[model samples]
Target: MTSQNQTFERLCRTGTSLSVHSTYEIGGEARHLALPHTIEEVSTMLEGATSKGLDPFLFGMGSNTLFPDRPSDDMLFFSLKEHIEFKLLPGRLFVSAGTPMTLLALFGLYTGIPSFDFMFLLPGTLGAGVYMNAKYFSHQISDVLETAYVIDKEHPERGLISVPLSGCEYGYKKSVFMRKPWIVVGADLKLPVDPQLTPEQTDELFAKIKSKNLSTSVLPNYFRHYTNELNAAARAGYELRQELLDVITDRGGKKHFDYPSCGSVFKNNYTIGEPMGKLVDRIGLRGTVRGGAMISDHHGNIIQNRGGATAEDVTDLVKLVQEKVEAEFGFVPEPELVIV
Candidate 1:
């Protein structure tokens, strides 16, 4: 393995700050990381890691993730900042996952394409978008994605291969690549150029939507939600229904607001029970607390990390809610993947 001094030459800490806590900014000490400048370099680094008996965890834009206070020490965190390469072909633009989704939206807006307008405000990476089928403002990344380049997990040296869009098997936020450690080198997106929305018009729409979106999120105590609001709202009555959704939106996107929570501490298990919100509420987990983490008062299914929270705090809170819900209801809310 190369000495630590040598590794510093190829990669460096760019910047670090308090990231907004949400799937967008689930809390942890980032130790802001960067990747080598080229794909071959990245491959070599991966190979080097293999030689050293270490595994690197792939991180893109750090969205849709929660980092425990103590993440795996052996894992070398890398970012795709330099890896993202953008290109324009005829009417379509090709983008890489390291490219911010917002950047893509801005590119489309400036260039007069309306398809990416909804993506303008999403807090995720290009690769993350392809993997998560990122959704917001009424569109999913898959709707605009054309193709992507993925590495062969079995063969690190096999390099990146372009994969067809249909093969991604997008459902909700899950995708084929999401379960695997294969890295995203870049991606191609088919876009339109004619009769495009003016940059000003696109910006106006984006600002309005972003404002509405922020107001709906960034609320105190609310963590990320367990399911989409529309589904829950439909379950509730009409006027009350809108109120339900508005409440969710008012909290920052998901389980990462006003606390150090791994968003949606529990995953919704549709077959085992009724909607998750009602079940947890019945157990009185709504507004319950364990250490610094608390089951949100606004939403029963969420566990908020109040401040100075630890992984143990959140985990214990999750366990308490699960046990309570199971005793009261005939079901257990499965944990969304815990970082630790």
Candidate 2:
């Protein structure tokens, strides 16, 4: 056996529950799973999967993904959530794919940069954010992203390839990464001003942020942890920005973390002159239930795992929404939720 194959085997966990890895807290057992903490480790795992004839399924924190109820035995499920890194560059910030997107807001708070406040309570990791052009109101990752680094899934030995912002073909919840077999490794983000912190201070700040022991995949835990951090910062005399405060109010008002959910389940059909949530509301689909899943009463776009929801339950609701909306509104709303 190749060294990479041996290392991959050593790194993988067998018969693991996928629920713990997802924000929705639903899913059955995965036959094989691995969390790669570095780019090299990711490449090694991919190589190993190829040699073993296993189909590799890659994901981040699984905030936007739904794992199947019965996963294929030959599928290798892996995530990059363990590979968090932050680097302060001369003109920009370098963040690893696995770093939680919400951490960027804390970085902004510590560094006195307001640009990342939109990401304050956003779910998922940086790589997923980049892939979907994750948005909050009018703000998005594409607004701050300068460049992305990726590994071609078909050619892992080619190493990292840099794709400039213009090459990304970013649109409403879309990116070139979605069209290609490219795995996002990291990205260089633009900073409006100098962070004004020494390298040691940056390291210290990041370490402090990461030391909080929060589960990024669990909504309630993730919410409380970051909210407390903001409050702690306020007590330390770091003046809180209104934008940051507004994010808390907006997301909090919507009860985003009150239930286990993958946030918005469908993309807004912009051509319809209204959002998917409002459309679902118009048709009286809000608060609709299917098995253990329910359309969030607070927000029509969300499908929550109220308790013990299965992947099929969520997908059933998704299908119901799509069918009802299509019949009433003359179009099928595309799902934003990734069903694995």
Could you say which candidate leads in lDDT? 2
- lDDT per residue for candidate 2 within 174-285, as digits (tens), equals 9999999999989999999877788788889879767753655889988888899899999999989999999999999999999999999999988899888899999999
Runs of candidate 1 with Cα error greater than 4 angstroms are 1-9, 12-38, 81-84, 194-279, 325-331, 334-340
Instruction: Please list the Cα RMSD from the true structure of every candidate, rounded to 1 decimal place.
Output: 8.5, 1.2
TM-score of 1: 0.67
Write model 1 residue lDDT over 112-181, tens digit each, in one string.
4667756543445677678767666457878877888887644778888877888888875678787777
lDDT of 1 at 153: 45
Clashes of 2: 0
Instruction: Give Cα-based local distance difference scores for all models.
Output: 0.58, 0.90
Candidate 2: list runs displaced more than 4 Å. Answer: none
How does candidate 2 score on lDDT?
A: 0.90
lDDT of 1: 0.58
